[model samples]
Target: MRRPWGLALLSLLAGVAAIAVALGPLLASSGGVHGFAFSTIGVGAILIGLNALRRNRRAPSAGVLATAVAGIGAGAIGSVAMLGMLVTSPGGPTLLPFAPAGPVVAGSTGQWAASTTQVTLTSVAVVGVGPTKQVVVGNGGSVRLAAGYSFRSATSNPQLDVRLERRVAGGGWTATGIEATVAPNAPLTAATPAYSTTLATEAVQYRFASGTSASAPVSVVYENQHLYTGMAATIYADAAPYCPNTAVEIAHLGGREAGDYAPGALLIRISTAVGVRANLTRASQRALALHECSHERQWLNYGGSQEGYAQMKAAAAADFTVGDNGAPPIEHAADCGAMALEPNGYLGYGGFCTRAELNEGARLLNGQEY
Candidate 1:
């Protein structure tokens, strides 16, 4: 029993060492473990300690005190040394260093932070599919973020710079106006002087060495008021660029036609880059045309009902109108009521208008005595 006790203690410590090695990478940023080689060696030391303990335990006549002391010494030294290297000098990691705050500036070019003009830089993001990474800095009351830096480094080039592109929601990531850079050797940190934007719901993701990443999307709020039919139409037109490939589909009454419905022309009352740039893919154009045609047929059979139904479907799918606007629940309900009664065209009276207009439209559509 006494002989085996020494082995048990050593084996336990060895297991602890191995665990530290495996967890080293995960805790690297926080613990400051720099090189993979060092981590592996640390793990091996733990294994050695474990094996020593096992050997002594199996030797019935072995000196229990000797075996226990040897195994414990090996494990203790290896574990302490591996952990100590993390926050030390030379190759020591640079993550949790303390620092002073600074100033911030904003411009069309981008938002920047610095103590002086020479060191100033804007918060920028370079996107990629791998691990997400980010840097957050405060500028006055505002905060700026730069994310999506690649983990791999360039040969000979010590300065690791990343590129980011500007694009709308649902659009392919592009490498246009967005860009950011950081020094690998520098301590990970936050700078002072922040910048703000109206797009609070937007998210910025950060990746480190291409694996699992983190995202911080913004938050915001606003109100939308009721508008006349024509006004609503105009607003849609003005916000065309924001809605890209989107257009108002009006249901047309079926004249003495044989088919249930005839497709309506895609209207472009307000010129949006999406509307003006005729480069819509064949499939996209076909889908849009077909959708509108469905509305026309529905209108002839029912009055003013198509938009409401479509909007309702959109809501169910969690697909909200993006970029330029949103749809209120009241308006959605009103539109649904209008479609139930007049399936053909926009009766222009049901959706989110004044209570009087809505009640009157609802009553007439329901065939109730007004």
Candidate 2:
């Protein structure tokens, strides 16, 4: 029997993941200094750890120390490399040189829509180029794309345009005629479109013709839909005004993933802001309001430090699944900070947990074990 290419790829990915998991602790200990370097180190560490652990208990060998040193050193190098990459171009900070929050630009298409994977086919419409990022889908049927996805076009008609039309479940590929032309190397602005659409959280694929140069289909992630509800309830139980009677608003910020304001609420940019609208889940809205309100409180109380911390928390909460409707995750550190601070029973991103459950979370944040 012949092995499928997908299976082979999966095996390779699994191997990589195993390596990453093993090295994660060492890399994490470095405080993510090497950006994705730790991830690579983690992979190496995992491979080493597994081999050592399986080799039967002995008084620890030079090999173990060697592996540890290698992992840490690699992690350090990765950190420096990532920092260099970040500071070397217009694309660093992801949200740095921040513009008013809007939609993220995907592929060469100047078109922006919020929902489902914003699949782009290079053959259909070529445009700008850089990272060639892709969209992330959410558990709630929302789709988000990272600003990293871009195209470069020096052609006379240097336009990056692609459309992600709705496809019938198990049907034909995305039709080619619906494609659009994207503006090249333009600063994303308020004039950007909020191309919003509803995504099916169930598994879906980006359909492009064979031999097309587009990247693979990235899934949207639906984070904490269940936990988000309970968290909102806990927050609104006390922080009512900010929690509003309705759900909070989320919008895609700019070429990069980020957040912004809306009428009486905040918008988490799911994809591009083109035709973007507030598509908040009942829980997501409440949690965001609480989260944003906390930001306001942080600004009033602690100033820059607290404000920065709050932003980090919001970013973590904003991380999406395979079909999330926001831009790629931003400010995850802030999210973790907020999670540590708000140790009540709310699962801000997912849903709710009992007071006991949340208390456990608090302990975990505080470095205590139940």
Cα lDDT, all candidates: 0.33, 0.33
**TM, every model:** 0.25, 0.24
**Candidate 2 Cα errors over 4 Å, as ranges:** 1-155, 158-161, 165-172, 175-181, 186-201, 206-212, 221-289, 292-370
lDDT of 2: 0.33
| Per-prediction CA RMSD (Å) | 17.1, 23.4
Model 2, 290-349: lDDT tens per residue?
444443332222222323435544533444221123322322222322344454422334
The TM-score, computed over Cα atoms with residue i paired to residue i, of candidate 2 is 0.24
Instruction: Show the lowest summed lDDT stretch of 10 residues, model 2.
Output: 123-132
